[model samples]
Target: MKTATGCTVISNGTAVIGTGAAPIKDATIVIRDGKIAYAGPVAQAPEVEPDATVIDARGGTILPGLIEAHFHPTYFNVEALEDLDIKYPVEYVTLLAASNAKLALECGYTSARSGGSLFNIDVWLKKALECDLVPGPRLAASGREICGVGGLMDWNPDYRKIGMDGLVLLVNGPDEARAAVRKLVKDGVEWVKTYPTGDAASPDVNDHHTLCMTFEEMHAVVATAHNHGLKVTGHCRATEGIKNALRAGYDTLEHGTFVDDEALEMILERNTPVVPALYFELASIERGPEFGLSQRVIDGHQETLEGGAESARRILRAGGRLGMGGDYGFGWNPHGQYARELSFFVNYVGLTPLEVLTCATKTGAEILGREHELGTLEAGKLADVLIVDGDVIGNISLLEDRKRFIAVMQGGIIKAGELFRSQA
Candidate 1:
């Protein structure tokens, strides 16, 4: 055998049917220098080098590592709102992010895109992982969300006194929006998030189609971000807001609840992917009362739950690109339960098991503009993979438990492992 350093092989596994259209049974995945070198049936796999290490998969099912396209690390504590005051504290928030990161990794999410966060903590967490100071998924973060004055959440005036300027940008007009985008880029933001439409609790004072930002203002944010080599994502729930965001060149639309037929057509025409964070709606309905939410909030959530599913169905029927993302950190939604999003996608959004898996893996990497580096199990791609104890395709819900995973590896390093049995 040829000699090589830094090599490992996962043998005798059932490779989960991938985007390539077929499953490779009795498979072996060879890794070299943190990249996949070969992935196929063991009988077809080329001979490995003499010094390579081998991991026996014990007939487990292997698949490309999962990716969560929209998550919030800092606000993860919203899962248990009885502890609200303490959950938002900076120290507590940091610990919560750390805990969520570890949970996500262990749960087979090798990479994630943090949609929005407070205090720009996602940036710090990303840096920490890169430096090996912490263990977590590979992260792409929007430092903080930029919203219109009194847009989504009210900003506290005390933020100025505490020097927490990087938390959120509350801009009022076109000029302010441009400046805010510039400031976020200067602060090392990977992407810029904007709240284009108001929520149920805070509807836009203008027409539903007319959002907080004028067309010019929205254009400025998108232009500034694109000029700086960054992408822009918008929170849009209304049909009017969805069209405006598409016209403004936003990369992705989040939580599109009231999307009409025409807007769904536009999304298909434009080829912009929509992240239907249905888990947020489901969790809100099931867990809102525990958090002391008023009846009105609970009722409003029910309406959204019903409406969002219909919109998702329409989007899928129209052949629009759809991705899976759990809006974790609100109501009972928590990090590391990403697979549940797939179940909702399959049952509620009408996606097949293969399609849902692609949304979480291949489509997710494409949304982040990292398809070549992540997404599929291919030669030269990062070695992010998961091996489950049973055939996950038949029952996707089995993925909800980390214990079902026989091995979790990221960058060719095994993060978790099951104890070995003697070869008697």
Candidate 2:
């Protein structure tokens, strides 16, 4: 339930302050009317009214609620795109999408940005969550992916040419590209997704070398999106595709698994955000056989898994903007395991535990363009807090356990981790 006005004093916790990567011992955070009123050392804490609700974190780490910078709420958790379309009706898929939204919040994610969605369901889902018809993270929706005809999402038999409606918007030229972006804007999306390159799962094109849409077409889409006050991102895996997308001014690159030195230089120069969702690729490798995927498809994933890690390492080492978000909601990866991406970043991508947490917290907010209000725990910011019952700084994997998340407060509302339900 949303509190109209409530004060919460969280004492006896180690507060992980925002952006600076420091912790306050014996911190006391006072939340008044759903905003962080005070967050500092216990000695400097402001005196609170006796009636205010108090939550003791038991000396656990209190960090900002994680933001899933790349999300697809309508996807079938663990199912491939083709299987999602073939195995389930749209009605079932819609219900599952709503379920995924809630799971995201339960996992301590307070916000999510839609990477893409089935139909315009993400736009409606965002609204539903806003109206409290459903429980979910704050979403920035991208209605449907804009793709060239015969692009990555052109998943259909050649002879039948079955309409893949509600998933991909097929465009051919610059005119069609511009039209598609305008239509997505009209459909109430904050971002427009495009398939700049074919993915590893595609049956029609090479995963690493093939370009899906022309440079001119992407330029048109980016221009239209920017003009309409929408961010534009692309599913780019090919080195050439990355170059084209950056040149055309796409704001973010999803699955930038094949970034060459030249592409990396351009991304650094433009300060573009890259979300290399490597967990999904790893999941594909582990569960492809169970999903009835061809060995060829399973074999192809290894390259992406290895290449994506190296690409991320390079980007991180070069001090480029890299964020965390699993391409969850597929059959194997699932929705609530977005934290696995953080572990992948630490172990495989060669980042420290603290670095991974920073990416998940601060860099994720930067990716969503909500760094001002979200991300770090600080005074005057929205109280999106995740209190984990462990030395989370020593082992980031503890965050993967929802039970360890003793309290999750989004705008001072306890959506999950009801640590003080009896007391309240």
| Root-mean-square deviation per candidate | 3.9, 2.0
lDDT of 1 by residue, 215-235 (tens): 677888999999999999887
| Number of colliding residue pairs in model 2 | 9
Relative to the true structure, candidate 2 reaches a TM of: 0.95
| Model 2: per-residue Cα lDDT over 270-331, one tens digit each | 99989998988888899888888777777778888898899998998898988788778777
Best by lDDT: 2
After the best TM-score superposition of candidate 2, give how far the Cα of residue 311 lies from its true spot, in angstroms.
1.4
TM-score of each: 0.89, 0.95
